[model samples]
Every structure is written in C-alpha cells, then in structure tokens.
Target: MARQSGRHFSGPRLSPEQAARQGRISQLAIARLGAREAIAFLNGNDEKLGGRPLDLAIESIEGLRAAEQRLDEWAEA
Candidate 1:
C-alpha cells in the first residue's frame, strides 16, 4: 500500500477509461435490469462472459460491448 500524508491507499485507482466503462455499464444495468438485478448481474460471474460482467466491461472496449449485448439480451427476455 502506498502512503500519502500518512494515509494508506488500498488499491490502484481507476483510470479515466475504466471509470467511463464502469459508469456506462452501471447505468445500462440499472435501466434494463432494475436495482436488485443490476447489482447481482454486475458482481456475479456470467457464463457467457466467462467472468464478472463488470470486470470484463472495465477491461476493454470489446468487453464493454459484450456486457452491453448481454444486458440487452436479458432485458428483452
């Protein structure tokens, strides 16, 4: 852990792109899945994604699109 002003940092900070991905995915999930399902979907592992949707989405543009596609599929069902 890094220390600054006697405070210890817990983990690496999110970059701007990662932050953007998180915001986008969260909004989409909440809008399509509602609050409860959105939380579960983001935090839970997805068989189709092969990882937690939120983590995949923040990893890259392709992952974000994949997560969005899954969200759409769930919303339509």
Candidate 2:
C-alpha cells in the first residue's frame, strides 16, 4: 500500500520489540493527529526526526526513540 501510494521506506528489518514500538507510535499519532493525518505523518519526512520518518526507525533503537519523542512533543503541543 505504501509503495502504491509512492511512499518510500528504508530501514533495517524490525525486531519484535521495534515493531511494538512502531505500533505504539502509530497509535499515538492516530490519537493525536487522527487516522488519515497519522498515516501521512508516518509516511512523511519529519524535520524533528532529521528528515526521517517512523519507517526509518526500524534501523536503530535510537531512531525509534527519536520518532517517539517527536510524537510525544507533538501530542503535548
């Protein structure tokens, strides 16, 4: 679906823990940004994330934390 939608994802294969974190971030985005916007945000590059999105978080735990932090800050605002 993402490829069909022209979204590009480049990162490492996700571990179970990383996948769980991704799911949590998605849920947070859904709650704060709404479903459609959350999907777009997840698929889009974020400046706060160093021009990376949640998809790139799979490459490293630090990347996942950065993504989570961005979402957390967004939720607080």
Candidate 3:
C-alpha cells in the first residue's frame, strides 16, 4: 500500500494591498532591534551576554506578541 499525501491548496494570489500589509507585518516583527544587533545577540557575540537559549526564546516570543498587537491595530485602522 502506498501512502497518499493529502493537501488542499487555494488562492490565485495576494492583491497589492494585501502584499503591502504583509510587508508591514514583517517590518513590525523586527522593529524592536536592528537586524545585525539581533543576530549578534542571539549568537552570544555581544558582551555581557551569556549563551542562554531560554532567554533568547522568551525574547522572541515577546517580540512576536508585540508584532501581532501592532498588526491588529493596523487592521483596525
């Protein structure tokens, strides 16, 4: 017996407005810090930083929540 992959796909494409909204969301997700700073911090290259995965994970979650809130506000406007 062969296993079948079940998948359902839909949608033609995102409209220009939708694409712009997505771009805004992406920007909001990283608004808290510079990309380079975040990369260095996550890799434990920053001074006063110990290699703590848990702390980094928590920070990432917080950042996501903030970005979600911003997106919500944008949607309401």
Candidate 4:
C-alpha cells in the first residue's frame, strides 16, 4: 500500500477585500523595507504582536487591520 502524504492541503482563506488589503500591505512593506526584508517581516514573529505569527495576524479582519496600522506606523517612522 502506498503511504498517504501527511501534508495538509487546505490553506488560509481570505475574502476579496481582505486579499486586496493584504496586497496593499505587502506593497507598503516592499516599498518601506525592501522586498526581502518585507518578506521576512511578514513571516517572522513580531515582538509587538505578543509573539504571534505575522502570517496569522494578516489572515483575519481584525488582525489585518492591526497589521495595516502597524505597517503604516512603521512607514511614518
């Protein structure tokens, strides 16, 4: 018998608006921090986020709003 792959297939789902916002945030990240740094920033755990994953933060409505606010602040700084 063939062994089944253990990897989960489903990924985090987002609404259209949420996705658009995510894209905007990503663009801001790229512009402010450079592409590589922005990617790392999104993938890395954040101190200000109480040690939560940034990926998780950008997945939900509230989380995305918070992330945008934080990113906006970062841009201004």
**TM-scores of all candidate predictions against the true structure:** 0.85, 0.62, 0.30, 0.59
Q: Which 10 consecutive positions of candidate 3 have the poorest summed lDDT?
A: 45-54
Model 2 Cα lDDT, one tens digit per residue, 1-77: 35466667886576798787688778878998899878887888887677655775665677777887787776677
The top-ranked prediction according to TM-score is: 1
Candidate 3 has an lDDT of: 0.44
Q: What lDDT is obtained when candidate 1 is compared to the true structure?
A: 0.93
Q: For model 3, how does the per-residue alpha-carbon lDDT over 1-77 read when each residue is reduced to its tens digit?
A: 99868876675665565455445445543464456533433334222223332233334554434445533443354
* Alpha-carbon lDDT, every model: 0.93, 0.75, 0.44, 0.70
lDDT ranking, best first: 1, 2, 4, 3
Report the lDDT tens digits of candidate 4 across residue range 24-54: 7688788887988778777767777654335
Which candidate would rank higher by TM-score, 2 or 4?
2
Q: Model 4: which ten-residue window has the lowest total lDDT? A: 49-58
Which has the better lDDT: candidate 1, or candidate 3?
1
lDDT of 1 by residue, 8-36 (tens): 88998999999999999999999888999
> Candidate 1 or 2, higher TM-score?
1
List per-candidate RMSD values in Å.
3.8, 7.1, 12.8, 4.4
Q: How many steric clashes does model 4 contain? A: 0
